[model samples]
Target: LALRSLAFQMSPQELDLGPEKVPGPVWGALFETHDAGAPFSLLVLHDGTAHLYLSTGGGLIGSHGLSEVSQASQRFMTQANRLHHQARPSQDHPLPAAGMSSFYFLTYQGVLCYTAPEARLGDGHDQLSPLFHLARGVVAALESAHHHQSRHTPPAR
Candidate 1:
């Protein structure tokens, strides 16, 4: 649903899903043992700074943190280093607010996003990319899991 919503809102071509978005140290390869009571969800969004998760059957239950999550900072620095050489021609940008990696999650019909009004405001649409990225990633993961379960083949080994 999240991905669909994002897709509706913008084109996938504009979104970045490369390794930079979901780095190696983060989106684990482990099976991670299921809890078996109520299905849960976990993901790192916003260049991996924010951690998003939820565990509840109904009525909406979720949590998020703004810390670097180790992986995010590593990725951020790597990303910055890669882009440092590409100088902007004219437009100057104010630095974003001092804060850890921020993220937003949606649950039970509510959309939660983190925005620092005092922070750097780039293009009007920039603030929204994090939400769009998270939503799309989560939705795709969920759909893949569902497909794997339906097929009963262990999600392609």
Candidate 2:
């Protein structure tokens, strides 16, 4: 349903799914997007917690969550599990969020997989990916990361 809604809002082409390198159990993943200065973020915890946040230029608008057993949360788990099984994205060591925006995939083993320009969205254009329920702190961390990534990325020439 989330995927369908996203596909409807944008084109199906906007959605891309690939294998995770060194695939295994994931701790969680964060996705972010900005529109007209409004920052939106989705954080999915491995336990099936999904946190959704909408903030106004770094200010909080509202936060919502779906419980682990909820259908939405289950759907998110399914998606992450799919990535774990099929794509198995390479696990990279977590680096400082200093230079660029890289996709960070933290595994259950405490491994952090970092990929530059976060290939999950194809070619890092402005956009949002979908996920299930989680926590505010987690979401905030993700939003902060997104903001950091956005601020750090050198604008296209």
Candidate 3:
């Protein structure tokens, strides 16, 4: 749904998410889509050091450093069945000693966003508030778009 909304409302331009220095045994993934005239991309990259970044072709927009935001985000995304994980070197850790996991969201205007929690396990939630709020707003926007679309579409024959 989020992807659909972005694809339908974003500009049709080339997105440049900048460069990444991913470490060995780790992989990065990028997802791109277009719909309703909107085009967007999501890039999840990790250096396999201690950082994971999310971007929309405009460089690093958000990141996670294995902190509380990471935990919370993981929990929420997992529950929502939107979290995608790669091979973990260990099962007990949220992230491997190297490598980073990717997450995605969007803005009200349909611009796509990527957020990866940083600051570590003990870090406060100040930075996370924006992410949470943005996600909430995006959800609302998606729902609203869905409702509007449903109302205008003709019934099946």
Best candidate (score: lDDT): 2
lDDT of 3 by residue, 1-157 (tens): 3432333333322232122321221233233332233333333323211121222323222334524334443333322223222211221212112222223322122222233433321144533443333333333333444466579999999
After superposition, the stretches of candidate 2 with alpha carbons farther than 4 Å from their true spots are: 1-24, 55-69, 84-103, 110-157
Q: What is the lDDT of candidate 1?
A: 0.31
- The TM-score of candidate 3 is 0.27
- Give the TM-score of each candidate: 0.25, 0.36, 0.27
lDDT, model 2, position 117: 34
Candidate 1 residue-wise lDDT, 1-157, digit = tens: 2422232243212435344444332221100011333323334333432222333422111122323243443343333333322222222212123431222222112223343332222223444333334333443444444455469855555
85: Cα error in model 2, Å: 8.4
Give Cα-based local distance difference scores for all models: 0.31, 0.39, 0.31
> Candidates 2 and 3: which is better by lDDT?
2
Error of 2 at 16 (Å): 31
Tens-place lDDT per residue, model 2, 6-91, is: 31133112222222322335545544444344435454544444455444323322223433233444455455544433233543
Q: Which sequence of candidate numbers ranks them by TM-score, best first?
A: 2, 3, 1
Best by TM-score: 2
